[model samples]
Target: MKKKTLLEELRSGTAPPFIRELAGEENMDPADLVDAMLRGEVVVPYNLCRKISRPCAIGAGTRVKVNANIGTSSDYTGIEEELAKLRAAVEAGADTVMDLSTGGPLDRVREAIVAKSPLPVGSVPIYQAAVRAQEEKGSIVDMTAEDMFRAIEDHCASGVDFITVHCGVTTRVLEALKNNPRVADIVSRGGAFLAGWIIHNGEENPLYENFDRLLEIARRYEVTLSLGDGLRPGCIEDASDAAQVAELVELGRLVKRCREAGVQCMVEGPGHVPLHEVEANVR
Candidate 1:
């Protein structure tokens, strides 16, 4: 018999330590949390390989969670500085951290951050793939689907608890974006990377097309997939536009797939929304 996965355990009516910890932290019942997990209402992103010291739950009925992103950029490739930011974010009560390193030794930076981080660590593997493509092939458009998936698997193998995948940035969504142009266009770097690849190669987004393969890796490592919004509004002026809505609709499909696969998943929303539109956006 195969080993039961985290999701399988939850579905079997067993509450794991992570769930118990998160439920206790949130002052909720463990059985109720297990029910939420089974219903795909709660996600506890804990890699079995990585021992988490600060486990926080994200989803319905839980207190709002905070995820702080700290990583090295091309302009500032300082791992120590990023580490300092990580420390500060944790001290200031960040529930999780995402290493969006796009510069310097990408793997080294991620390993260092993940090794030191007590909170769950997440990453955008496409960023590493895009950076590798630029360094080796001279452009983000040169990043192959194999490179993207390889980076994702490597990140999971290295104990990343979660990952942000721009699975909704499809050819159809690009058509929607074209028909209803936004002032900001595309603001997500990973989204833009995949978009460039699709347009240049005339292919479907690999993350969207080969989602089952992605799920296999996520299931093996128990990595939660944060379905990214590639066409999310970069500015208030572009809030609630057709492109953004289209991507959200695509993400909804991905979320359903995730539940069917028994892999934890969450939807990533827009970058900006006006005060008046926040309620609508949440709805």
Candidate 2:
């Protein structure tokens, strides 16, 4: 029999040990924490693959959390440098750390991060997928759907506690972008790869098309799904545009699917906006 996911167990009225500990850390009643989780107002991003010593909670009734990103880019792929940043994140009281390495020694870098990070770890696995496609297949647009899913699963098995997925960049959303152009069309790297792939292949986003497969992989590790809004505003002029709202609609649908699949998920949002639009964007 398959193991019950954290969400499924929560649905069965069980508060897992980690949740209890996190509640105490937040000085919140465990029952209240569990209640908030059930209400889809809180998340504890922990992967079963690794036991985190510095796990923390996010969302309603908990202190605001910050995640530090450390990784090696193609131009500067230094493992030691990344480790230094990891140390800094730990010392500076980061709630979590994400390894966004997009260079060689990818395996080693991620392994080192998971090995050393006491806090929960996250990643944007598609960066590796896009990198692999660019290196091996000659173009990021040439990467197969299988390649993306494989990257996601590899990261999950490697102990990534959570991951950002750009599944909301759909064909319809692309069309919306064409209809209403922006100063910055797509500023997110993962989003750009996916948008390019969709245009080149004339197909739907593989991530959105095969979300169930992604969910199964996430369920195995109990990885939290950070549903990324790929078409979020990249400038003040693009704020609340049709493309942005269209992508949000797609993401909202996926959140329901994640709930049905018993996967813990969070929604990412607005990128850049005018000062007066900040509250509106958040709302």
TM-score of decoy 2: 0.97
Candidate 1 C-alpha lDDT tens digits along 1-283: 6567788887787767767777888899988888887888788898877888887788888999999998998899888998899999989999999999988888988988999999999999999999899999999898888999999998999999999999999999999988998898999888888888999999999999999999989988889999998888999888888888888888888888999888999888757988887666554
- Residues 1-283 of candidate 2 have per-residue lDDT tens digits of 8999988899898877878888998999999998888777788888988889988888889999999999998898888889999999999999999999999789789989998999989999999999999899899999999999999988999999999999999999999999998998899888998999999999999999999998999899999999987988888889989998899889988988998898989888778877787676554
**Clash count of each predicted structure:** 0, 0
Q: What is the TM-score of each candidate against the true structure?
A: 0.95, 0.97
- Candidate 2: list runs displaced more than 4 Å: 275-283
Model 2 pairs whose backbones collide? none
- The 0-to-1 C-alpha lDDT of every candidate, in the order given, reads 0.88, 0.90
- CA RMSD per model (angstroms): 1.5, 1.2
How far does residue 201 in candidate 2 sit from its true spot (Å)?
A: 0.5
Write down the lDDT that model 2 would get: 0.90
